[model samples]
Target: MKLARLGVLIDEAAMKRLHSYGLNVFERYIEEILEHAGAPFETITDIRALDDRGFDIVIASVVPENEETAERLWQYAEHGGTLIAYGGLGLLARRLGCRQRPRTGAGYARLPEFRSVPAPLRCLSAQPWHAEDAGAGAIGALHASSPQGELVGPALQTFAVGRGAIHRWAVDIPTTVVQLQQGTRPVLHDGIPAPDGTADIDEGILKADDDIELDWEWDREKTATGMPYFAYPHADYWREALMAHLVRCALAKDRTLPLLDYWPEGTGHVALISFDSDFNEDERAVVTLDVLKKLQIPSTWCMIEPGYSPQVYERVLAEGHELALHYNALEKENGIWSLEEFTRQRQWVQSATGLARVVSNKNHYTRYEGWGELFRWCEANGIAADQTRGPTKRGNVGFLFGTCHPYFPIAWCDEGNRRYDVLEIGFLTQDLNHPNLSDTTVIEPFLKQVAKVGGVAHFLFHQIHIHRLEPVRQAIREVVGKARQMGFAFWTSKQINDWQRARRTMRVTGIDAAGQVRLERGTVNEPVAVWLPTSEAPESIQSPGIVYRYGVPCIKQVHHLTREEAEC
Candidate 1:
């Protein structure tokens, strides 16, 4: 097989120093890796007149400067090509005119080692959108917040175009000394191979205890200021990133990337909690039950058919918890049910729950593949709210999906309203990931968030998931105690739905003097500190919630049967 060919494009700032904010040191590293990649490679500071006849993918990177310039680079991708960039997301999406801002600090990077998470986009981190020029099959890996305090994984994402591929990365560049690569791009090979790309060395650094050596060369070129790399070792790390991104462009795969799930703007704020069996699988449910029992907090549980160990379901129903059907076929993980199967399962659970009027439903694993048909079936049969989504599977699949809160929405986007409305309850972190999260930290981070906008925290704890951990009950007890202390109140799915009437009324009535723009629900003036919806600033705001979209100061309620005042 023949080797691949690539062209490197960078601004003038990258050429002077081999390792600076732009491309200095990266050029040397790029040369080494391309040579090692067993392919013809070329580098140019000017993108104007490059002969594009023989290259594969384009690599782009982010800096404290030149952000706007990055936008112009999309032409390369739009013209049936591929690209990679050194930028973080959430903020990245917002920056690219996605029209929405990040809320609270949702897209944060927490690397304890760095004492850093993508901190409020002062310079290091940013909210950017994917290049729309690239096709929708783009694979995106974002900065995941982990316990290491605040570290972003060297992540990578890719997409396909007409006869080409586009790749983007938040990665660590390669270098001659340590032979390292960091950022979000994937590593293809390891070592400072021979001129023809053969190897014999420990190249890159993976996270601790996971010895995955990096692949490629660590080429260091001299600069006048000697600050070729940015600050600290990060210079070398970024250099490695530039190389890895280019390499991915050279050897990307041919497959489809999953689309993220997002709620449409008009969807209201809602919460969905199912009262079902612990099956004893989830580690937190039992303790959660204990907590709810003590707090006397009412909740709705979607009882799973046949899976609900009869006795538990009876007790849950007797406890007066609202019962709804949680549907799933006989086979668990690999099961794919048809519309009939879904309908049958729902009816079976409804009968077993003994609720002659089982009017609500949520799906197990939140996977209702044919939701459109299922929701339609629900509407025809009197289901009120379809509450089957949250911090599902992996929480990163966030984008635009269509429902916001518990709303009477036109069910599926394309098919129009099918009668059954799907409500989107915001998500809370799963205990499995943050087992150390006592009831204290769980509510601490979310309090200021709720106090400001009144969104639901939606924490999940199964009896089993919680029982596996020590002092589980205390964690539950603390959460209940804190709710009382915070002066905030709780609302079940049904109650919150009922309250939207008053809330919406208050919202529109309190419309600010601005007199223009629309107002969304959860708008409050109760000493609220928001993650301002503009790229203005984030240095000060005691409140810690992150907002990904802007607000127009309308009160949090709906007035008459009509949309209110317009811009003057």
Candidate 2:
């Protein structure tokens, strides 16, 4: 069977905002989601030439560039081409079963078919539209809370044209996903009120968690510890739903797309345990190391100033654990948030540990000030991964930053929305057993949701807690055990950074008309997983670099293939 090809139509005007905002939700950000899904697609700017190219399905990420473009899209759908309008359908409003709603207010949206998980209605402000029910059935609906109480209307709907259909999303899926992932620009200081004292909001520094837009009541669920728990990754869910719909459209056209598995060896998901080595407590480090040794799992130890003894560092290296830097930018401990301080501390740790380079870092107390300065410093210091973006308050635990997936952040101050060399691996919460922070109740749900979203479930533990608190120790053991039972492999921060960077280079070179896919990767130190959607298992397979294959049941039938670097 032949696989259908997809074309992503983007507004060049909207993408121009990348210069100021670092990224535009409707443009580069949406493309990132599609790339991660491993869906074969082409970006088209000229809608006039779209009819000539053989694209089975088209995603109008832009609200019709002009009248000609809008007419062309409607004709394409009428002539048997699947068209998915991301947000604004402009001229095709009445044709696609939607009437413009003249109102702007705060609201929440839920897809009943998708477990009724609620997400903020972003499209209402962009282009408010309600379903007309003129041959189209609503797939999802939104409840807008204005001064006039609440108004319920259709949020998502699909209707057939001549031979094909058009699926419209009123929530501006791309914008919502991007906002959830990157968060808003921290202009001056605080965004969310930290009444729990987890952070000193009045300090006038914009911490990573401060940029989070999740509402305490609307986005989080109540926990056993009475803390606000973010069980659902609204952004990732939107991305997943968008991709699932695209895949279904392709399948309807007798096509299949390839997807890159999140973990190595076809692992369902991954979990990472990291420690902030506060005050260089070598004795406490030993106790934590003992527990990890008992479990035979490697961990990442972030070294603060005046780190552990040389012997302890040697032991950590010998035990296959990673040694990383814990940057302290707090004012109380004579800390300074500056590039000079970062370079100084980075140099001290590297010299003390006898290492030429340190690959990872986590800030002390998650102290952040500016927007992209931390990322710039990381790139300058050659640090590949940073784990500071997470919930400092117990109320913000679980997907606080809207993702567990590590990604290279775009330099907000840089031109062309250029990405930094550093990959941010945002932690979920600090010290699960901490009374003022989090508890064990979130472990199972957090890990499960992360696995569903196919990202790392990274948790932070301080050496001080591990040494002083028995509950913390037990919590660590339980979390690791549960993750293992759920098919999650534990990995250190360095390992994750290495694997993710290596896999980023892997590209789908081509997919033939006969559904055969060709992939290309640069020289990598480890093997990567590539999955292909198939209706049936192949009796025999022949592909270089792929050393093993496994059958894994998912939303669809897929064969998981592990592709290793070929022998030189």
Q: Which residue runs does candidate 2 get wrong by more than 4 Å?
A: 11-14, 17-26, 45-51, 62-64, 94-97, 103-106, 114-126, 131-133, 145-151, 159-163, 194-205, 225-227, 411-414, 509-518, 521-565
Which number leads on lDDT?
2
Give the TM-scores of the predictions, in the order they appear: 0.40, 0.85
- Candidate 2, residue 426: how far the Cα is off, in Å: 1.2
lDDT of 1 by residue, 1-568 (tens): 1233345565444443323322223223443333222223456556553335444554443222344444444545556566555443233343332332232122222222221112211112333344443433333233423212233332344454345544444332322211211112123223233232221222332111011122111211112422111111222223223433343343343211111011112333333334444363322444555666777766776666445555656766576567666666334454445667667766777677566766666666444333255556666566666655432322111111211223332232234212234343433433423343322343443443333333454554445545566455555556556655766455566555444323332221111334221323343212211111222234443324333321211112122223332211
State the displacement of the C-alpha of residue 367, model 1, in Å, after optimal TM-score superposition. Answer: 1.9
lDDT of 2: 0.72
- Model 1, position 247: C-alpha lDDT score: 36
Misplaced by over 4 Å in model 1 are 1-274, 278-290, 307-314, 329-335, 392-404, 407-420, 432-442, 466-468, 501-568
Clashing residue pairs found in predicted model 2 = none
What is the number of residue pairs that collide in model 1?
109
For model 1, give the RMSD to the true fold.
19.4
lDDT of each: 0.38, 0.72
